[model samples]
Target: MSRIAFTPTRVAVLGAAVLLTAGAAGVAVASGEDVTHPGKRIGTQDAAHPAPAAKDAAAAKAKPREAAALTGSAKLFRKTTEDITFTFDAHLAARHNADPSKATGTFKFVHLEKPGGKGGWATGRIDCLLTGGKVASATGIITKTNIKEMNGSRVGFSVHDQGKKDRLGYSWAAVGGPDGTKKLTKCNSAAPFEQVKKGTGDFHVQPWKLPYPDPR
Candidate 1:
């Protein structure tokens, strides 16, 4: 057997050829374009690391917020008759971030006595829009008037249906003064009716100390 002699130049050439072939194969595998599978389709490999889920984007667009609750009581007194006091209690709820002057809820009046001894408790629903914590317009009913007719013909009158025209109803508007007062223009007028806060209860919650007992 004839012995072959090793040369540096020959060895370098051979090494370079091998490196080129290996580099080409590596490129083919990386790019998924191997010459051996020329006709066959090759699926591209995904990234080394997967991208994170986009849950934050979905969380950003949330549902609308709920309305807020406002519960409080006010002393409704008339400027003309300050001595004759009437306790006005309100249990109202407001929409989200709504103006405090605008609220809708229940209102109760206790000991609303007239100078002629014709007075009674009034319980009704109030839909009031206010301006600067002053009443803009308040419309409600005098559900029951414990006062009797002057002729003593009827002991008391009860509002059977709120929708009925015959039912006693009242409407009020703010009378712009230092005191938060409103003027009753419908169903027994009382001018310069002041509203003073007594206390506050939970917001957006109802049925708190309403439908009070007869004070007579």
Candidate 2:
């Protein structure tokens, strides 16, 4: 994990998937169907893309090992609930000795939730998972404010795709929060992005939220 001090003028910047999981993917019967989101019957390819994308082959061989390495790396965890907050990681060797009541560990959402015209984002949640020490799967809906930007203190999901030499198609977005109201507000979304392979990726963010869905 590398951190560059952020300044007013010189702020240094560092740094997909879908409901469609593996095994759920299928082949299209007719032409003009979406090979990406199969069976759903969106569209199809004019040509039969039988040749396995070289990108997928490479990712198949590499992602697992990369995930393992990330799982073993030490990470920081902080919980926010109300006025009480607790932060821990390789950076902090000392356990913060503060009045638990004063420091909260949940998120407070303000200026983050922007409802999508009619279809409100609902039925979403986030649960970060880690092993050995480092953050492996940030498995949950990361609120816009809680998300770690490219220049954030934390490193992005290089743990998932080791073959990714460029940051083009390697970014992800958040889901939802404690309340169902504020859905996934994407931060630093790398849109119009394509996967190098057929797999899911994790979304990293602040371990905790601060009074999310802030009453405005």
Task: State the C-alpha lDDT per candidate.
Answer: 0.35, 0.26
lDDT of 1 at 216: 88
Cα-based TM-score, every candidate: 0.28, 0.17
TM-score of 2: 0.17
Per-residue error at 189 for model 1, in Å? 8.8
Which ten contiguous residues of candidate 1 have the minimum total lDDT? 154-163
Give the per-residue lDDT of model 1 (tens digit) for 1-216.
135886999999999999999998887777778455564444532456332344455455564332322233333334554322332333234342243323445445444344545544545544432221222223344444453221111111111111111111122223221121223322122233333322311111222222236888
RMSD of each: 29.1, 22.9
Query: For residues 1-216, what per-residue lDDT tens digits would candidate 2 score against the true structure?
Result: 247876754532221133233324443334445566545455333345533465589678764322111211211121312221111121111122111122211211122122222211111122222222322222233343333331112111222223321111112334322223223222212221222221222222222112236578
Cα distance off (Å), candidate 2, residue 46: 78
